[model samples]
Target: MAEHTPEDKAARAAILERGCSTPIKTATGVWVRCGSRIKSRCESCAELYRGDWAAIARSGVFDGPVDQYRFYLLTLTAPSFGRVHRVPREGGQQGRCGCGVTHTTKDAALRGMPLNRATYDYAGQVAWNRDAGVLWDRTRRRLRDRWESVEYFIVREWQDRGVLHVHAIVRIARGEAPAAIELRDAARTAVAVSKVDGSVVEWGAQAQCDAFRANGDGAKTIWYISKALNYVLKDVATDADDVPVAVWRHQVALGDAARRMRCGVDCVPQDCSSLVHQRYGSRSQVVSASRRTKYRSGWSFTGLTRTVQRRLRREWWESQQAEAGADTSAVSPAPLEDLAARSRRELVARGWAAP
Candidate 1:
């Protein structure tokens, strides 16, 4: 390994403080110009943040802009894997031993250990992830065949490396009275969910049911769909050789960014925010009893109380809509009248009978 001399140490410190491309010292005590801010970044830090961004983006199935929630059943899914080693916790191997104490079982002994093992069919996992978008389409076709009310279910998968997960937002038309629960159940049943070796994929019915119960609203059926999709589309391997060049480049950039910044991908923005905060040296200050600090300048450019993402998204959407000559003002509006009207119909249909 190359030893970090004084110049190298100085360069690392400068990069850490000012970022990569800024001119700094090199190992030979020469000031070699580092990459520019545009081209230079902490690669590892970037990857981690990109991964986090991807996860959050995929979670869009769980929440969305107003007016569109009524028409979609968002979902996730995962591939099956064979059994492997076990930890004492996490419902690992529980068989008794001749020695009296419950001992951890071998890989072969735990062949049927109920879908917790990471030893998946690598090829199947890769293939599944690579074609998860297609698999989702097939599942949608199966769903339409089973349910008459279901005009179509739009299926999309978020590929986070080999871990092929899905994010399906099933779109239903207006004035449909399909039993959402039954529709979801039938879709699950019809879909050919299984391991590469042909073991039936374990549908997490309990979790899915729990999400719906917790929400306690018929309109919130999307929660169950979100849970189901998230459950099924668990981690699966991806073939490195099969990755596209562009994707590989993006992944590498993100990975490098992540490493240099010493932060996870989702936290990149946070990391950047933290650095900005440190630069400003500002602390939380409460102005009155009714209001506390919603956001600080250090954390973000325009810090506020709710939906930090809303502002960023709103701006982006505005820009896009403007370019496309679409109306941006009506994109997202929060009004009691609108909420009441939407809720009235849902409440009446659910037989709330509230005073």
Candidate 2:
């Protein structure tokens, strides 16, 4: 590691004070952001994460030609392994649960608990979660075959019952757009057989989709999809402190099922160290956006990704360091070439070279 100037030292200290709550100091006394995505774990980092994704979400809707595209907000859910108590959210419609008890907002903890724990298909639920990625791939392909000029950004979030729920914003060319219900029906009916376990996976009977125009009601739709990002940051097994006994048992059963489930075709549950088992059999990313291709402008037109964001921060820091050390004789550390940040600067300053 190279030496940093007094100005560079001051900048690092300021960052340490304002960034990650528990940042780790490198051996060279350099502090790096903890890179945590959980709000509870690190509010500053997580908020930065949320803001970036929110910008990406808005970019797909607002950055494009607003009048030329149609957007739809869609939610797809997992099939129920067994009936669970359906306690309404605060101020939601009060209804009698299957167990003959009317659960109110006060009974929020019991929302996803099984009425008959003995019969709840914890194994089936975990298996479905593990295979959710495959199912979505098939669904998206199906949607593309059905619709023209399809593009999307999807988020996978946890339901109170520890199952994954998908929220997506789908975009299509204006002239080729279909009704929201048609898209929902096609997505809900799409199914795939898991290659890992050869079991069929499908969405639940319930699905919701609503179409909005970028020049019209698209902002509301973007906000709705972005709101689901809050749950995306949270761990599936989080918030276990002081929970009801039933809720704890429910989570424990799901965890056990996930642990015992096979993550790969040849996976041995007892010895496999895959984190999928720890995450309730969920191996998919919390959020996914389409990538830019030669033919299609997917997700963000600027091609913003977490890597891009990190590189931006590093570039800014390197610029500060270079400026501070201008009067000093010490050579500044070389920036990462693969990041292209330093290369772009070198090109602008000295022109492209074969070497």
Candidate 3:
């Protein structure tokens, strides 16, 4: 890596101090906004990420021929590996823990920690996380089979117990849509035989489906689902300092199990360098939306996506510089792959100092 010049350092600092707050240097040696969805990593970029997805979520609900369709908020959970304490959210009611103790909000650290760590089935938990995507794929196929017009946007979240749980915003033709309970039942009973190990992957009994009309209640439903998706890219590992010893041990056990598990059928656990092991067997994007296909309508009516969003931002910035009469004659309109090696003049034209 080459050392940055004084002017380049100033330019990078300007980007970091102003909009990005946490600019990351790419392999091209260009300083740019860190496009992380995790708030702890980059708050500005994370909120922007959340807002962009929320807009897309709203578009699927409010835009297009929504009157002819019905919307549903569906949630599916991972099967319990073992019993855990039920500590409600702050300000909520307290309940008796399985260990014969009335636990309060302060006991929240133990909320997802197994009562008996010795028999918690950590291997099964990690394996389930690894195959969660396959299970969801099977579930969506079943839904599409039942209702041909089904389209969805799904967000997978990590539970405190280091397991993956899913929430989906589904759309189907009102004519073909059945009752909420029926949809819930079908999704709950859906199963997938993992290609990696041939083990049957199934959802937990806890599932929810709530029907909401696109016109009257669509906005509220969109808000709820988007809020639920806010934690999509959050790290599953918890800081041991604030948590109890058992909870810390639980997370360690999960990490150990994930490290030993083969990510793919051909993967050698000992030699593999995949980050899935570091993330407790979870891999793949946390947020997923249906793509527009030949015979299918996607989740977004406006075809809004992260790629589109980035392109639009670039276009908007170029237009702004054009309006300001910034000279771009020195800069070549490079291909997408070469854009990362941005010219100093281009950065200066964008109102940032550069060498």
Candidate 4:
């Protein structure tokens, strides 16, 4: 790693002060960032977002009347249409997959392979991802009807089989959450009636809902949701040979099939992008809502939300300064033009000649 110059330090300080942008290296080798939230696309900004999430989750920032509210960790999964390559939950388990090999951590290639690619429901998998957000929205509405208010952070995870499911941290403003059975029943109702182009969609019957009392600072629930965000991956595999033969073929086929899928309303396409866009619009990665506020879109932050964000940014900046051994001693301010000249000189010294 190269040592940061005063210009680099200034740019980073500006980002910290604004609580936005990312640090990227410029042509002159100065570090800066545009502050994107997609983890796979930009790890630097994503880490900051993750920290913000953890802080909001653990700090009672969103939960009102902390003692009166309740929380639930809900995992809603797509129904299995066929067997797929899966890691064994227990040791010494063998022959579970068609490959008949006991898979270990070393065998990342075998993680999501299907026994029979031809029989796998690739189109259905894509459809499920598209509608998962709607199903969740309906579920939240149901919760809100019963409770005073509802706020949730939903994470979409790709199963080893390439199917999408959700792990949500659901918060109710007051009162005990309904029993798991009742919650599952409500979720089933929400899924069954959720329609795409007048056709009913289903979320399968494999919903898991676990409740947590408002106790002990709510660290466990916060940590669990934060850990869920960490599982988001940019790419499952780098090369074709990295995954099983069938899995690779299936992926290629899905890509080819998706390209042909239609976009816009009323097209009812089978491709992944088209399906997701048609169902959930362009933004579908994370869905959140608060009954108390008007902003209910994906990743939208309210006024209070901004305050929490700033807090997270301050904490991150302090931590970074500590790690870099930055001096805290005050120094006399330099003129803006002098600072610019210094940066230009450093850039020229580094071979970034002025144009």
Candidate 5:
């Protein structure tokens, strides 16, 4: 680690006082991130947050030796405004859009671009994004009322047509697991009405609620949700410099619309400026409040809080180190390349290296 200059130290101190982060410059000519959780702003912190979220979900599911929980992987999607470019299932398969081009994995332009940008519902898209949290809250409360004790981790994702959707991992007590169909029905009912402006917000006909019985280690479900989070984080692009030309144009349009749209009288005069600032400029993007806090109205938790989770994680790491004591014969040095790669990953995750 490079020694910080007086000015750097002062800036860091000020950031700490404000409960924020200050970027640091490294010797490798890369700017160390401030660990922002918004993927469009900081990929490194987004990855770290995803890993931590996965671990938290896993711990909630597998807290006991024997599998004793019931899990539901729920997907809630918004209604489509228009068709968009979709990659074919296989190499030789036909494309789904009018573009008639089978986009490959490397074709970033087709990922989130609309078939007709001018006809896309930019206002509805931004409104949905702003109201997504509210919808999730309603659905969560409905689930909790039925299951009694439930914990969930939800992620919001952007679709190929530039709309927002949700993916959630919901856990309930073992014997209290409701039928998948019933859960789906409840979720649908909860989302049929919008809490934002009393308008009907449909979750589309493609909503899914998959139930998984926790047997053995219960790692598969955890890994699946974690992978979904990874995808969501990786797909976010806010600036023209960070994405392909087509995708950049779409994002710029969305940003502009988000800055201008206003829904109703109670709504913020600006395009949810408070929500945008809270999401992009503060630690609220990653750090959630505990159930005991005033900000816990939305997603209340009955399992481990962040502080307890961190303590348990530290204890587990220490125990692993103790178990590996003085085992030079059993341990082998990692490859040089692997070590370098891991160092880079850690530095990036900890905001000491650029993404």
Candidate 6:
């Protein structure tokens, strides 16, 4: 770190407050020369930064295939505008009525009637998209209440592919559950656990709607979760360089070329690159493209082995069963039934049809 000159301090305040197009000094006194875009930096600094980002993205964790015991897809979304939409009138007769009313059957009315008021706020939507990532992070932490024991949950990252969303795989410890009913209970409990202040919006221009889904099928679930997380990594950088404001540093060494490359026993020093080239001609071009692309693959977690992946799977399995038993034993069976009913109602209100 370096000390900032007085001019740097003034520029920093202006850049931060007024979005000035100049270099700004951070509080720690490091000068952040704001480029037109992240790519437009001082030549030396830009190359170093891009190379760093490229390295990380080329070898990031969330990109590769992972072994999971269970898989699930969770949907987290922002609420809609409160504007009214035309709906079919229910229980109407004479085919028409005064007040410009068009009559229809009960079923038609139910089908056509707007479920709720609609609203429109472009600014709110933009703001919500900006804050969606933060909100998801907070919401995930709030989910701890669903478990008697603290379960290990690691967020892969929010993804934006064909759709923009967040994905995470939670590893539950094993204990009691071995059936779908118990697993369903855990999933419901996980969904029910929510943050009170997760409004994500402070005013009329606020966005709402948050949800989650849990898969407890052991390794398959983890694989799916990893895949979901991979969706995000496929198109972005995963190092401090891409996120210059970051307060931490993450780096990896290549180690022995053979070991790092996972080369075969037959590979020799002089023929390694040539051997690899022979084995992957056009494929090398694809790898090169990935190297230049914004997406990253070198993060620590991405380097996990099947052994580690399986261990996590087993841990989550045990945790889930243990949680199920504890929950079942802690309360009366009648209360559980009541809980189930209420949960069903909430689900229905949220758009799921009743059984």
Best by TM-score: 3
Predicted structure with the largest lDDT when compared to the true one: 3
**C-alpha lDDT of residue 231 in model 5:** 49
Better of 1 and 5 by TM-score: 5
Please provide TM-scores, in order, for all candidate models, with all chains considered together.
Answer: 0.31, 0.84, 0.88, 0.65, 0.65, 0.27
Number of colliding residue pairs in model 2: 0
Order by lDDT, highest first: 3, 2, 5, 4, 1, 6
List, in order, the clash count of every candidate structure.
Answer: 32, 0, 0, 6, 0, 43
Candidate 5 lDDT (Cα, 0 to 1): 0.56
- Arranged by TM-score with the best first, the candidates are 3, 2, 5, 4, 1, 6
| TM accuracy, model 6 | 0.27
The residue-by-residue lDDT of candidate 1 on 143-225, one tens digit each, is: 55654334322323333432333333443323443455655565455344432233333322321211222124634654444
In the predicted model 5, the residue pairs found to clash are none
Question: Residue 97 in model 5: shift from native, Å?
Answer: 1.7
lDDT of 2 by residue, 117-139 (tens): 89999999999999999999999
**Residue-level lDDT for 28 in candidate 1:** 30
True-vs-predicted CA distance for residue 87, candidate 5, Å: 2.1
Ten residues in a row with the worst lDDT in model 2? 327-336
The residue-by-residue lDDT of candidate 6 on 1-355, one tens digit each, is 2334655555354334433243433333333333221333233323333343333332332343323222224334344433322323333334443224544433232221222313223233333433444444444444434432222222223211111333333332234212333333333322221122234431122212222223324465445444443432232233223332111111011112212231333544454542222211111111111112134222222443323433454466447758876321211111123343454444445554321
- If both were scored by lDDT, which would come out higher, candidate 3 or candidate 5? 3
Per-candidate Cα lDDT values, in order, are: 0.35, 0.76, 0.77, 0.54, 0.56, 0.31
Q: Model 2, stretches more than 4 Å misplaced?
A: 1-15, 24-31, 218-222, 237-242, 326-355
Name the lDDT of candidate 1: 0.35
